[model samples]
Target: MLIGDVARRSGVSARMLRHYESLGLVRPTGRTEAGYRAYSSEDIRRIFHVESLRSLGLSLREVGRALDDPGFRPSELVADLIRQTRERIAGEMELLTRLRRIGAAGPADWEDVLQTVALLQGLGAESAGRRQRAALSSGEESPVPVEALVEAVLNETDPNVAGALRWALERSGEGGLTLLAEGLGSPTAEVRKRAVQAITEIPSGEATTLLRNALTNPDLVVRRYAALALGARGVADAVPTLIDMIVEGANDVDAADALSALAADPASADEIATGLVGRLAHGTVEPSARRRLTQALADIPGTTASRALADLSHDEDRAVALTATYIRKLRDAR
Candidate 1:
């Protein structure tokens, strides 16, 4: 077959075939009567082979080495191709995400697009200060996409940056609630915790509803966070979890504070005191837990809390007695 026929049949252009010949990747076996490059069957086969290797991302030089170097090992080269392919895919995916976020922002012009891109880059910057500044300025001018804020908040390790990101999301309205709710189900414990924490900052009823749903989440950390946020919001549903936190001694002080906050309501006060007193009365309650419960009840008003405190003040456990006695005196002083 002549060069044209070889090019037409093999799908390799004539110019490319000539280039390959120059590079010794493939050379026509002979010349036709017109002095046209004529490829033998074996030469055409080598051309297909070169094309096949190039499809796997091999450079021309590497392709030549692969075909001509008998000593070349394919394992290392194949592994390298795999690594490079993964890297390319990751880069492309990241670019696609940025484009989607920018489009979601509904940029009015090139300047808007540029500003959105800069804010996005800032959100992902290595320096925490830059990221924090980006988060703080997200709502100004061209607003950073809510999805980007949610992504940043979920992945952010810096406390300052995370807070700013959450604030940005709150200003973005409930747009990020769905994404944050999805984060609540992430397999990563840290992600679930971040999701609940971010949700806590949004004062929307929808956000409150999401936190209510999160109350039943399998993660204890998520449940505790939701309970704390809910308690602060005067949601009575968090009372049980708050009591449990006090019993487990996990963030027991904060849990007591949350319970105290919930107890501000007249109807909630008796229920809160009852829950704590019940825990104190449990036979399985540890001495430390009993003391924490007694301390927790001291903040609760009404006859129920006062009665529980009076009973605990004379209890057999000396530390519990001392703590409850001290709390009763404070209550009397009030």
Candidate 2:
């Protein structure tokens, strides 16, 4: 077969075949009497082999070595190809994500597009300060897409930067609650905590609903954060978890404060005192936990709390009795 026939049969362009010949990747073994390049059957087979290897991302030089060097080992080269292919795929995926984020931002013009790009780059910057600045400015004039802010908030490790990201996410509105809700289900405890924390900063009713749903999250930390946020918002539903926090001594002081905040409403004071007294009465309640619960009663302002303190003043545990007595005195002095 002549070079033209080989090119027609193999789909390798004649120009590329000549370039391959120049590089010694493939060489036809004979010439026609007319002096046109000619290819033998073995040369056609080699051309097919080169094209096959090139399809696997092999460089022309690598293809030449692979075909010509008897000592060439394919394993190392194949592994290198795999690595390079993976890197290329990763770069493409990252670019796709950036384009999706920019498109989600709904930029009105080229300047808006550039600004969104700069903000995203800043959010992913190596410096925490830059990330914080990016987050703070994200929703100032034109907002970064909510998805980008949520992504940054979920991944941010620095406390200050995380705060800024949460603020940015809050300004993005209820859209962030969905992504942050996904974070709540993360197997990583820190991520779940961050998710709830970011949700707490968003003041929408949807965020509150999400928090109410998170009350049942399997992660204890997530439950506590939800309880704290809900309690501050005067959600009576958080009372049980807040009381549990006191009994378990997990940030019991803050939990106590939250309970007190919930108690500020006249309708909730008795209910809050009742939950506290019920925990104190549990047979397995630790004396230290009992004492903590007694101290927690000082913030509850109703008759139920005053009556519970009077009864606890003579309780079996000296620490509990002493703390209750001091609280009763303070309550009576008022």
Candidate number of the best TM-score = 2
lDDT of 2 by residue, 1-334 (tens): 8877888899989999999989987888888898888898888889889989999999899998998899999999999999999999999999999999999988889999999999999999999999999998876576898888888888899999999888888877788787889999998888899999999988878989999998999999999999999998889999999999999999999999999999999889989999999988899988888999999999999899998999988998888888889987877788
> Model 2 — TM-score against the truth?
0.95
| Residue clash pairs of candidate 2 | none
TM-score per candidate, chains pooled: 0.93, 0.95
Off by over 4 Å in 2: none
Local distance difference test, candidate 2:
0.90
- Candidate of highest lDDT: 1
Off by over 4 Å in 1: 332-334
> lDDT of model 1 at residue 24?
84
For each of the candidates, the C-alpha root-mean-square deviation to the true structure, in angstroms, is 1.9, 1.5
- Whole-model Cα lDDT per candidate? 0.93, 0.90
Candidate 1 structure quality by residue, lDDT tens digits, 38-107: 8899999899899999999999999999999999999999999999999999999999999999999999
Q: After superposition, how far is residue 300 of candidate 1 from its true place, in Å?
A: 1.4
